[model samples]
Target: MATTQSFFRIQTDANLQSMQVGSIMRKVKSRAWKKQRYFRLQDDCATIWYKSKKAGNAHSTCKLRWLWKPPLISISDVEAVREGHQSEVLLSIADEFPPDRCFTLVFRGRRGNLDLVAESAEEAQSWVKGMRKLIENLENMNERERLDQWISDWFKKADKNGDGRMNFKEVQDLLKMMNVDMNEHHALRLFTMADKSQSGTLEDDEFVLFYKMLTQREEVLRIFQDYSSDGQTLSCRDLEEFLREGQLKQDHVQQHSMELIEQYEPSDTAKMRQAMTIDGFQMYLLSPEGSIFNPAMLEQHQDMSQPLSHYFISSSHNTYLMGDQIRGHSSVEAYIRALKRGCRCVEVDCWDGPNGEPIVYHGHTFTSKILFKDVVTVVGNYSFKTSQYPVILSIENHCSVEQQRTMAQHLTRILGDKLLRNALEGKGSDLPSPEDLKGKILLKGKKIGGLERSLDGVVEDSLAAEVSDEDDAAEIEEENLHNDSIRRKPKKSKQGLSKELSDCVVYCKSVHFNSFKHSRIHSKFYEISSFAESKAKKHMKDAGAEFVHHNARQLTRIYPNGIRTDSSNFNPQEMWSAGCQIVALNFQTAGMEMDLNDGLFTQNGCCGYVLKPAFMRSVEKRFDPEHPEIRDGYRPVTLTIKVISGQQLPKVNLKEGSIVDPLVRVEIHGVPKDQARQETRHIDNNGFNPMWHETLTFTIHVPELALVRFVVEDYDKTTKNDFIGQYTLPFSCLQQGYRHIHLLSKDGTSIPPSSLFVHIRIKEGT
Candidate 1:
């Protein structure tokens, strides 16, 4: 069956200078055992042995030969050995030495002898040189091919579909196995680059190109250059090597010697821009030779610390240098920059623009313009790390309800599948979708008790548009709207917390309602000069921050444990009995205040007097000295309010059949002198009472049965225009016989002495 007998031959001098070619084959194979060896060629001075087989196969056949003419070394082997040697430190002679002159090649276990092709020694040497050169070239090409094959193997493993190609999904899963995390956009970007044909999959040749691009140094030149300074090579002392070694150097290790070795050589910052993740670098090596390689991947070196180097920078603008020179920063840059700096949460302000697009801005009304949708555009296009996209986009919506919903839809449309789909597909179908993110997103809206709007519609709509093929598609869209609405009814607060909060708090109270004398006194010590005191408070609470209130109504919304409260007027003992800790005191109170009191400070936690040297001494005497009741603290008190009266509060109704818009009118009143005095002086200190008589009317318009609330809290409270008695107001109306509001904690405990419970019924034709 076999036309030619295949075997291996060993050659040496008559003096037996070498015993076996087995050792040489073993040495060559040792370095790349994980890789397959499809071809092996071994040669001695007078004889040659050759083996060829596929990768992953252990057995190979060998043919032995002799020179019919004078033998000469081939230039191909010379080049192969030369290239291999130069690429590795261990194979130092690979490039520099001639393989024919150095050693012989043979098969490990094959047994045979060979026919002679050359006669004279000189002729044989010349013949061997020529043949060896040809063989060397073949080997060199094969080695390159072998590397390409390795890349193909990796691609196939990642493909998962056995399609001989890989998509973004497959690459993503493979990256996970390698402990390399990549975002869907980034993964797709890389996959698209490797796909070449744009087939959404990578073929073997594409895979080979990818493999070559990844391992090749061209794309990662800048990164590697960054790690190496003054042309000094990365060695055992480098952080990567040290991490691999897992050995810590002793403190006594000589810094002088290391420095003398050019460790102190200035590193080029420009070069650092060239660096990329090792994975990215490897992927570069897999790229096709002629294709344009995007070196953008090697843009940051800051996160490449000691052990695991996972950071990749795809563009220059998204990169943050070691110092403050942000590459491409606009006013919107701060938000994204914060994420690059590793902030887990960020504050974003949103407003409805003339175009009705949601835009980001810190100002209010159209006069202070910033588009919310623009912020989304910047973020979606310019994320540094895929995971960093999860960083909270804290939004403060200072607009009307319809506008707010429209803006939310605007965000959905802009971010769309690019941002939401990848995040959703990566998750289980059983979980709630984007609709669940509505209230969870920490957006500021008009809700009295910090009510969370149902995100079911938003989530269902987002998911309805995009779903993975693996998911059940039949009933998804059909059930989305209806099921979402049913699932979306405002989640009632657990136990009695929601009910209790409803009872005590007023939904719409203003600082102007407090007395002028009290307000003046309050204004003099701190600065709460605005009638819209609750605006900042609302925003802060939405950001998941804890707000402390000076009054019971403002303090009524504390639902979580870690948030501390310090009341100035309420019975500290009574509040303590109500599970509140820390009693805060007001500095505006004339005489001696209680000791052990945690004094609430302003925004910077620095007494306003700190900005001026003249008042510093008085501040020091009152606060810095060992005062009995005043302790050190810097928490700001926040207040939330709602308006309750409309018919009296104005009431209108719409039945399932009737056509009348529900109307309610609420008057916001500033705190008066009596209430201020009562709060400042002890409640038992004579008949001092604070009354809120001045009213500024605000209107409420909502669909029938819409559970609406107006949440107010103070973010910037100063002593200047301070409101005394009550701060927050909360109310909800239903066309029924009885109406009541209650206040409860984040846990479920109710605070007594909330607002008064009222009952009302209107006749058909009043």
Candidate 2:
């Protein structure tokens, strides 16, 4: 068990501290679906519980106003709190409820947003400010303190009687809720030991001790003993040896050791003597520095001053769809989600609508439609929230000149200074860098003529040029996607562009791809080509070197083919290898492909742009991803990982008495030669403290482009393995030595206390 005390502390505002007395507010799902519900923050300050009408009628209120239920929202799960009619759901009721009284709780993960309308604006303000404060508090918590808070919240949940204490039966129920199926006899023995009062129940402090006893990692203790000089703590020299030998810290080893000891060692005596206790060592192992991903890559460390073509941009296709392309709902919430996830390029399929307005949706489909103005409004507001880099609005214009003028007006009015209206003056053929275009929005669509025409001048000043058949191609792709037997030639001619909309295309002029040589000979630097995934794959295979050289000079975007109606994604690495800058995926879909995309952009301050590798950026290199050995600065590495054990893996099934048989899978995604997969044997009938003790090795040839994914799944012989949690990162960001892989839910939110412990070793020249 942990040392005799708990280390949990929460600093709360005076208003939140007095929140035991809750308030009543209207919970709204849609314009017609609004109900009054009582909401209250739990005493732990980590959960917000609201009572349903049925529960309110049948159950008596507890000390708090809300009923004890499973529908409570954790404070940490809230991604953002937006005021006014921010969401499409909220904006629909703009006439019913005033903007000042409406607010939305934008939850992380796949959970739907909670729209609420307060009786007064003051009530809405209080909740928004209060919820933000609790989120801030959770964000500021250290690892230990966060664990302590988690344990506390569990304790509150397990105390079914609301008596401030949990009996043995209640503790058993708590164990199941925490995703641990432990041996009953073993659990009782530990429970008896923790109940020092011999009262057969655990108070808050006793529960903390019990948690420690149940979670004590003998594997970690063994490592600590191996490095400890006197069996109690590790001296500075001992730590230095561990850092140099095991962690691959070649320079300033002694300094790194001392800094870790001074920062994590809780005991003043230990800090003064330059020693690390077991607790301190474990704490250090769980900190960000000891995380599986390298902390250095978490900042803006890459050079961003290069041309726009010299980087990979995180992009989203069909940015307004929340589901399948044929019949999905179109909402502004999709744009918010993409932008918040550091997406720099988003596609909008604009078609003519009523009132001279342009609407966004897949054409010739039953998918719902949303106003283009609303989409632009959200983009203007949230574009720079996650990344200050430029956002490319990939426009698929199927609108006439009249509605196109309205679309142009909305762009200039709603986006204002954020939109790049005027073309860069006298910049030759080279496009600008992301660094130079920060906080700007660039339209990616047809330009009627050259970009020299003034944006504020007359709409008739620009020359009209026939737009490409890209929109026609889109219709043909959809037709082929649904009916493979029906093959029709794409309509050759399309409507010309409106000069008003054409002026907004400062850069990223969409052009049809004929050939690489044709582009090099005739295309300007600002011009770009959009390719369907199948077409891009053909070029990557047929002319890999030429594709790389072509991308080294101008921007290329690869989007998913129309056949993926389920909104699935192609492996982005395939396009990245060809040096394609914008490889658009369905951001609403969560899968391995998006995981790798997130990994690449997560570094470099998560600014949506990552610099292309040196070999891919050089026109002289003429690199081929299919032949990595020929690339410059190709250094392979050997990654060795010991699948030591798991700590409290989340159960995939919530069915009563259901337990997980967890297995760990490690995968490497990169150039063809470097891709590999290895997994550990499943541990049966245990989600808590399952030890694998297996080792998996991989040889990553192109380390710069490689991504390592660690996954946990529940084994089931009768069906497909159910996913539990996973963490993925760039292979170069993998840190050597003992570390913890903090797992994430399928929707990419941290699943606290669900993690894997492993010892990593990396050596050069694999």
lDDT of each: 0.27, 0.84
Off by over 4 Å in 2: 1-14, 53-70, 452-472, 482-493
On TM-score, the leading prediction is: 2
The segments of candidate 1 whose C-alpha lies over 4 angstroms from its true place after superposition are: 1-344, 364-367, 385-389, 417-766
Number of clashes found in candidate 2: 0
Summarize candidate 1's per-residue lDDT along 1-766 as a digit string, tens digits: 0100011111223211221121112223223332211111223222233333233334533543222333322222131112111112223343533333232221111111111212233333443444354444334432233333234434545877665566766766655543233356765766678787888776666765654443333313443355443433443244243222211223432442243223222334322433233333222222221011112212221222211001111111101111111111123333343333332234344444575555543231112333565556555543433222222333333443345566556555655543322212432312222223221212211222211112221222122212111012212322443533322322211111111211111211112223333542442211111211133233223321111122211211111111111212222211211111112222112111211111111111111100111111121222211111232331211111222211101001122221112111222211110011111111111011111222222222111101122111111234322111121221121212112333222111122112212222222211
Error of 2 at 405 (Å): 1.2
| Every model's TM-score | 0.20, 0.93
Clashes of each: 140, 0
Please give, for residues 299-340, the per-residue lDDT of candidate 2 as tens digits. Answer: 989888888999999999998998987778888899999999
